[model samples]
Target: MFDYADLLTYVLLVLKRAKLPQHENTRQVLRLVHEAAAEQNVPVRLASDLSQKNPFYALLAESSLIQALEIFAKGAHRCA
Candidate 1:
């Protein structure tokens, strides 16, 4: 079974790997990402790569996983 906390941890790990500090905003972003991710039934791995496809790395470099998850959920909802 996929653990949500593990997934969230992985997101944080990736950010830290990219040299993002664990600041107040960073925690907020993680929480948002967690909530958005939970809404989409998104798995841990996809959550990790959700921003990897951007040519500008816009999502990965700027927006947090929560924002990406929100976009994913919105699109998924619209398509459904």
Candidate 2:
């Protein structure tokens, strides 16, 4: 389990390592996570285990993390 900050940092690291463009959608998803964390008034680390049972997981789906990952995958594919 990790906090929102950890999640954001991981994503940033991936983007940097992959040299993927930080598209608006990616930013929006990050923003949604931030907002959700704030709204829940709980540390995301405590609230999330990256499981489907958590609110964070629902937010991930709603915010389209998979799409963001797909974008990253496409960028990596291009580089390859």
Candidate 3:
């Protein structure tokens, strides 16, 4: 089982690859991460868990907007 941080990293990577800018929803995303983590009975946060080598950060740094869009589209379908 991946940690909340790892899962969050995955989500962030996927979102970035899908090309959807997160905008000012960091707090909301954090809340959702907290809720999701709680449901899994684990506790973690973005600031606390993220390290210098965060894969999610790498993806964002590269800023592949089109890829981010695709990833997000798939995610949206799943959620819907």
Q: Estimated TM-score per prediction?
A: 0.21, 0.21, 0.24
lDDT of 1 by residue, 1-80 (tens): 23454455556644455343344356544654666546645444434433323111135556676776776664432111
lDDT per model vs. reference? 0.46, 0.41, 0.44
Instruction: Judging by lDDT against the true structure, name the best candidate.
Output: 1
Regions of model 1 farther than 4 Å from truth: 1-24, 40-80
Q: Give the per-residue lDDT of model 2 (tens digit) for 1-80.
A: 45554465444543444232343346544554565545544344432333212122222445565665665564432111
Over 4 Å off, model 2 = 1-24, 40-80
Candidate 3: C-alpha RMSD to true structure equals 13.6
Sort every candidate by lDDT, greatest first. 1, 3, 2
Q: Write one digit per residue (lDDT tens) for candidate 3, span 1-80.
A: 22455565646643444232353556644555555545543344433323223223223546677766775665432111
lDDT of 1: 0.46
